[model samples]
Target chain A: MSAVLRVQDLSVAFHTRGGVVRALDRVGFSLGAGETMALVGESGSGKSVTAYAIMGLLEAAGRVTGGQAWLGETDLLAADLSRIRGRRVAMIFQNPRAALNPIRAVGAQIADVLRRHGGASRFNAGARAIEALRAVGIPDPARRAKAYPFELSGGMCQRVMIAIAVAANPELLIADEPTTGLDVTTQAVVMDLIQAMAARTGMATILITHDLALAAERAQRIAVMHAGHVVEEADTATLLAQPRHPYTARLIAATPTAAGSLDDLQSVPGGLPDLRRDDTPPCRYAARCERRLASCDGALSVRALAPGHQVACTNPLEAAA
Target chain B: MRAILLRLVGAIPTLFGVVLVTFLLTRVLPGDTATYFAGPTASPESIAQIRTSLGLDRPLPEQFWRYLVDLGHGDLGMSLTTGQPVKTELVNRLPASAELTLCGLLLAIGIAVPLGVLAAVRQGSLIDHACRVVATAGVSLPVFFTGLLLVYVFYFLLGWSPAPLGRLDAFASAPKQHTGFYLVDTLWAGDFETFRAAAAQIILPAGTLALFALAPIARITRASMLAVLGSEFIRTARASGLSGPTVVLTYALRNALLPVVTVLGMVFSFLLGANVLVEKVFAWPGIGSYAIEALIASDYAPVQGFVLTMAVLYVLLNLAIDLVNRAIDPRARRGA
Candidate 1:
């Protein structure tokens, strides 16, 4: 399948009072048409930063230093995103209620996006917004459209957010921890809604999440990140079954499976290296890797063990099962 | 609408409290109303008869009962100094003060809201710095001092204003009374010359009040806008590809308006109080001067009537603000 988004060597730096914090460093990933890829990591892992940079939604203090985010023919990092942001690529953020305008009606919010990118006229935007709401499986979407974000449940708000995101039928969608504050059942429902919408539109999805189990269940491919680097990338089955990188193995061990008890979970030891330090090592996970070698101090490179599995480490873990 | 009606009904007790406080406080003031009205060389018998005729011989509670009854009948008694009914005196003078306060407040909002929003949007820019300076200067300087400075610059030095006079210039006469707001009445009377003269006469005092009112309004707007700008919804709005102006003006500004409007209500009441000094400086014939003149002679009726009018106006203003707030914010409609 042809790729819809190909990000290369994306680096983002935030200028703070202390020093420049390299939030994302040479992070790269790609998604093919209709493909669902999850960028999974812990907090401060640059997953959301990469998403924001691609969407041109980074704060004033942060800027893309070096990167090329090619959305087909256009370089997203360089293009005027005002026209492309909601039209060609859209996003649904964490905290669905906070992500929506509190004072505006949910339907008006949807209509705003529809008119902006969906090519709906003023008179037709309201009706088209109701249709968009109905597409997300909202009950009585007509009345629900007039309801404010504060009036809706968290799951319903997420669904409204999804409706707004997919209003233009964009070619790419970035969901940045879209189910963070929702309940477990609502999480599944919202994730299912996103998957169903992506399938209907054939839009490429970049799901940024910290839940490894969620990534395993929903994403076809997964990219594991630590600090600011994409440390490993592979098909979800291969990565989960025979994780090559030690960090990926530790991540899998950290997850609570159906059969695994509380005592069976193993956490990855040590914290992420300070990205602000100028003398920090190239391989951010090497300091925490038990399999770290002297060579790990040198330049880190991606080593492909199988046809579709790649890991960035000097000493890799052998395939399990 | 029900909310407005409720608020109106609720305001009655507050107005009554104001009336009660004003009545008692005026009674406690130094110098005697009967003595002052009776004159210096009056005989003891004449003074006694005068006191009796003026209802001063009645006990406090009875006097209060009579006052309340008169108030229920829309009578504010009579001003000893002017020999006119206090209600009629207040009715004639209130419009000038109302016109001045309204003009000042409108001017302050028109300038400060945009200035504050711009300062927040282009934070740390020269415009922001200028707004800070303007706000600080407005807040620090006294209203009377600013009034005098304006009169000095525009009337004495620059020759742009009429003499720091009352409502009209020597050449222009008062227009027919429709709204009692000279700007409205002159326009209604098709007297462009008087309108221009009225505008000129009002410019200094209103500007003085506007300068004072704008400081807090601009500061609050800037603070509120800064907060709204940092919220997640703003980033969401930007991600949704709404135009920069739409996101800032419509989304950001509307969210910022609640606090700004709240501050506006406070600033308005403050402006009314500040109007007294401004009115005194400009020699304007408004209720502020009327009350101050009555207070000096210890003529209790006009002073009491003045406080009552202000209290009623404040209650009504608060109701107006509540309605405006409801219109601006739906959350407020739910009483949230």
Candidate 2:
């Protein structure tokens, strides 16, 4: 099946008082219709930036220097933000409470999207909002519809955010750290709700998160980003079982689940290079890589290791093959 | 509704405190009503007689008790300067002050809110810079100087304004008092000529007060709008694909209005206090000038009455603001 969304060579830079910081560089990924992909990374690894760029919701200082984000037939990067956003695509933000309009009723917020994009009539929007809330497993959704964001708990707020996101039933959904602040149980429930909805609607989803375990558990394919670059992309089980790039192997090693004991958890050596410098290397992880080779220089490009598996490093770990 | 009623009931003690403090503070001034009314050259015996007749010779507690009794009976006491009942003088003067203040407030909100929202939406643009300059100049200039400058320009230089001397021209007869507001009263009387005269006379003072009121309203609006626009919900609103205007006006502006409403209430009260200078400059017969005149003459009853009136007005204004705030912000309603 043709991919529902395909983002290619995306580069984003933030202009600040100090200098220009490249927030995202040459990030590329694709998700087929009804497929689930997780963009997993550490903080400041451009996972969230990539999502925002595709949604056309970057801050004033951040600009997309080069990119082509194709959502079906429309180029999301070039489309009018109003034309694509909330209609063809939607986003569920990290902090659900902060992501909602505090003063407005949560139901009204959902109804707003329905009316704005779903073409729901004003008279029936209220009922449809309650229906949306119910679909998210919110108890007493009719009564809860009248409640504002402040009145709800954190988990409930996330559910409301989910409800609002799926109200219009867009073709693609970008969930950026949707479960970061939620408890484990609530996180599972929220993720389950999203998965169920995506399954029912056949919508493609890009789950942006730093939780490697959660990504490995939920995603069909995983894209590991580091220092503003996607270093590895492969099937979730294959990537975790046989991580190709040294960075990906280190990430899997650092993750608590894959380690045999607490002592076995190995932190990645060194740090991500500062993107503000003019002499920054093309492969940001090169300086931190223990398996670096002399040829790991100049512009790095993605090379296929196996079908549906790619690594951006010249000296990727080839032990499994 | 219950919250509003509770707030109103709570205002009683606050008004009483104001009355007690004002009464004591006026008594502590260097001169008493007796000496001022008796004149500087009056005989000692005549001064004593005036003091006794005016009930100033009574003990402080007895005076306070009698004042409260008279207040309960709706008698604000007799003004020593004008020989009229304080309530009657206030009734005659309050509408002018209200008209001027209301006009100033409406004009300020009209100009400031839109300008503030525009500045915030187009932050760092030329319009934002211009708004900043306007806000700075408004807060920097004293109200009297601004009033005088306006009068000089509009009346003296441009010859576009009427004489800045009270609510109407001296030669024109006053309109019959129905509502006591000259603008409304003239319009009620179907005398467009008197309405035109009243409108022309009020322009400079109201304009001056509007400038004073605009700064805080605009600044608060801009700051609040900037904050609300930067919030995560604004991104949510934008991501929802609501049109830009809908997001700015419905989502951003509505949320921004809470602080703006608060500042508007404060600015209204501040303008009432600031009205003294504006009234004096234009020779308008408003309560601010009346209070000042009574203050200069050490006329105890009118001064006390003016303070009491102001205190009551403030309490009521606060209640109104609380209601408006509750209407706009669900959180405020829940907290209350």
Candidate 3:
């Protein structure tokens, strides 16, 4: 399938009093029709930053220094705020509790999206809002539409957020930590709802999260990020069975699998390199790599491990290749 | 509901605060009504007789007790200047003040809310910046100045003066004065021309008070709205395909109103208290000017009545604010 949303070399940066923080450095990824791609990373690893850039929801302080988010023919980064805000791209945020308006009813929030993009009148818009709520498997959608955000559970609120993001039927949906704050069961249900909706609508989704196991199960492809770079990208099965980059191997080993004990599950050592200094290298994961060769310091570039899988490093760990 | 009750209970202190300050402040303002009324050179015996009869010779506590007891019976005290009962004076003047305050508050809210909302929606933009300048000017300039400016515009420039200065027209002789308000009285006069003229005269004063009120309320409203707009829910609402107004009205402005409601109560009480100056500026015979004349004449009844009424007004305004707060935030009701 053609790429529903193609993000090419999108790098976001923050200029501060201290120095420029290269939050996202030449990070590239894409989402195709009905496919789920998880951008997994730790906090401050440019996971949420990349999602914000994709959805065009970056705060005033941050800027998309170099990038383009394509929604069909429209370039979202270049689109006017009013045009992009309601119609083309939609986003679901972390902390479902804070993501919804407390004063407004959930159904009304969904209907709001529909009304703005669907050209529905007040009556029809509300009907469609209820329909969107029902689509996300919310029971008694009409009655539930009148209920305030606080009245509902966290799971319900996140579902409401999903319903809102999907209501306009945008080709691209950026689910930014859609289940971060939710309980385990609620997380499963939310992920299922997101996947089901994406599949039904044939919309591309970039699910930014920190949960590797969940990403493994839900994502068609997983883009493992380290510091501010996409260190490895591949189909989930291939990446899991034969991980290439050292960071990706460390991440898989770090996953809390029932097959491994605490001693076997080792975390990657050392902290991420600070990108403030001018000497910061293209290979951000080089500091944490076990097999750091002399040639590793050269301009690290992407080398294809497979037809569709790419790894960004001068030296790959022996086990993954 | 419990919070509302608690708020009502708290109102006692507010009422006491109003009466105490009004009473004490008027007393200590370096002017004595007894001396003002008796004149610079009067017989000591006549002064003593006047003091005793006026209950001034009684102990301070006894005097305060008498004032409260009379107040409970709805007797504010008589205006020494007019020989009218203080209750009668309040009853007579209340409608005019109420009319002016009500209109002024409505006018203030009408202007302030929209202006504040517009400024908030487009913060740092031209409309927002211009309104900021206007609000600063509105708040910085005194009510007296605003009233004078309005008079200059309406009376001097436009030649559209209100029926003299008083609330009622001198010619109405007021066929029916049940409402105690001039507009109501004029309506009862069955004379639209007189009513229209009375309303016209009332408008300038009311409008002046409103503009003075508008400044702070606008500034507060804009600040509150800016904060709400910055909240995550507003961002969520926008991302949900909601229009600017929908997100603002449903998500942003409704939440912002919590602070605005509080200020509204204060503004209501403030406008009532400030009406005295406003009435004087407009040359209208409202409670403010009445209190001054009564204070000078040692008309203890009317002054006490005015202070007591002002106290009650302040307390009641707080109560209204509590109820409004409970109504807007569902969580507050649960907490209560």
Candidate 4:
């Protein structure tokens, strides 16, 4: 299947008084129509940065040094920000309460996006906004539409945000830790809503998260990132069964699941390398790898281990024959 | 709506406290109005008669009681200096002060709000630097000095402004007092020439006051806009495919305006206080100058009346601000 969205060699840096922090380095991934790809990593691992960079929503200090994010025929990075942001691609932020405009009514906020990008007529925008809200499983959507963000619960606010992100039914949706601060029960519901929406619309989705088990459960494909580099990418089952990169193995071992008890989990040692350093290594996880080889110091590249399975390391684990 | 009512009811005690304080403070001042009116050279017998007639011979409690009764009846008593009723003086002069204050406020808001938004949008750029310089200069200079400097430049150096005198040219006849505001009164009289003269005369004092008012308005706008611009909602707005202008004005500015409106209310009260110096410099016949004159002459009634009026105005102004704030921010309306 052709990619609905293809991001290739995306590199970003933040310029600050201390130094230029290399945020993302040659990060590349692609998602086919209606496919859900989870980009999993620890906090500050450039997962959110990659999402923001793709949506052209990076903060003032951040700059896309080199990249091409193609959504259909248009390169999103080079495209006019307004053209592709909501019409073609939409984002669901982590903190819905903060992301939703505080002073505006939730209904008005949804209607704004619908009118602007969904081609909803001004006269019918309110009805369409309520319809969008109801689509996200919000009960009494008409009454709730008149409420402000502060007036709603966290879960409801997130639902409003989801309604806004999916209002235009864009071809691609990027959810940046959409369930980060929510309770477990609400997390399940929100995730279910996103999955259901993506399936219903046949829209591509890039779900960025730190939960390995969640990625395994919800995403069709998984990409493991460590210190701004995609360490491994494969089908979710293949990545979970036999993670080639050492970091990916550690992550899988660390994630506690219904089948695996807490005692079975093993935490990875060492912290992420500071990206601000002048001599930052190409293989960011080489220092933490137990199977480190002297050749790991050289330029690392994504080597295909099998069809549709790639790992970026000089010495990747070989599958047992 | 209930919150507004509560605030209004709550202001009763605050106004009472102001009344008590102003009454006590003016009475305790070094010179007594009776003695000042009697003159330093008057004989003791004549002084005693003057004091008796002015009711200074009455007990302090009884005097205060009578003062309260008169105040309740809307009689602010007679000004010992001007011999006019203090209430009448305030009524006539209040419009002048309101006109100047309103004009200055309009100028300040018109210039500062846009300038602040631009400064915040292009933070760290040359325009931001320029705004910073302007705000700093506005805050650094005293109002009197700024007024004088403006007079020296526009009136003396450039010859663009009217003379630094009262509301109209010295020889111009006073227009019929309909609204008591010269601008309104002249327009009411259908005398465009007098209106032009009044408008020109106000430009210098109002402009001077506007500079004083501009600094805080601009700074608050910049800081508030900067904060809102950095908020997640602004990102959401931008991500929603809004054009740059819509994102700034509709989303950022609307949210930013809450805090700026709060500061604007405070600035309005501050400008009213600052008007004393501006009035003195420009020789504009406003309540501020009247209060200062009464203050210097130790006229008890006008000073008391002026303070009471200002206190009431402050309470009313705060109420207006609360209403405006609630109108703009529904969260505030809901007390959320």
Best candidate (score: lDDT): 1
Sort candidate 4 into its docking category: high
Q: Residues B1-336, candidate 2: write the lDDT tens digits.
A: 777788888888988999999999998988777888999899999999999998889999999999999999999998888989999999989999999998899889999999999999999999899889989999999999999999999999999998898988887888999988788899999999999888888878989999998888888999999999999999998988888888999899999999898888899999998898899999989999999999998888899999999988888888888888889999988897
Per-residue CA lDDT of model 4 for B276-325, tens digit only, reads 89999999899999999999999989999999999999999999988899
- Name the weakest run of 10 consecutive residues (lDDT summed) in model 4 chain A: A78-87
Stretches of candidate 4 exceeding 4 Å from the true structure: B170-178, B185-191
What is the alpha-carbon lDDT for the whole of candidate 2?
A: 0.91
Q: B217-273, model 3: which lDDT tens digit per residue?
A: 998899999998888887787666576677778788899999999889878877887
Model 4: pairs clashing at backbone N, Cα or C within 3 Å: none
Could you give candidate 3's per-residue lDDT for residues A199-277 as a string of tens digits? Answer: 8988888888888998999999999988889989999998899888888888898888877788888877888888777
Between candidates 1 and 3, which one is better according to TM-score? 1
Instruction: Provide the lDDT at B319 for model 1.
Output: 82
Fnat for model 2?
0.86
Separate DockQ for every predicted complex: 0.83, 0.81, 0.54, 0.80
Error of 3 at A294 (Å): 5.1
Clashing pairs in 1: none
Question: Which prediction has the highest DockQ against the true structure?
Answer: 1
What C-alpha lDDT do the candidate models reach, one value each?
Answer: 0.92, 0.91, 0.80, 0.91
In model 2, the runs with Cα more than 4 Å from the true position are A258-260, B170-178, B184-195
Superior candidate under lDDT, 1 versus 2: 1
Candidate 1's residue-wise lDDT over A1-321, tens digit each? 578999988999999988999999888878899999999999999999999999998999999999789999999987999999888999999999999999999999999999888889999999999999999999999999999998999999999999989999999999999999999999999999999999999999999999999999999999999998999999999999888899999999999999989899998999988888998898998778899899999998888788768888889987775
Over the stretch B1-336, how does candidate 1's per-residue lDDT look in tens digits? 677788889888898899899999999989887778889988888888988998989999999999999999999999999999999999999999999999999999999999999999999999899899999999999998999999999999999999877999788889999999999999998999899999999998999999999899999999999999999999888888988998998899999999999888899999989999889999998999999999999998899999999998988888888888889888888854
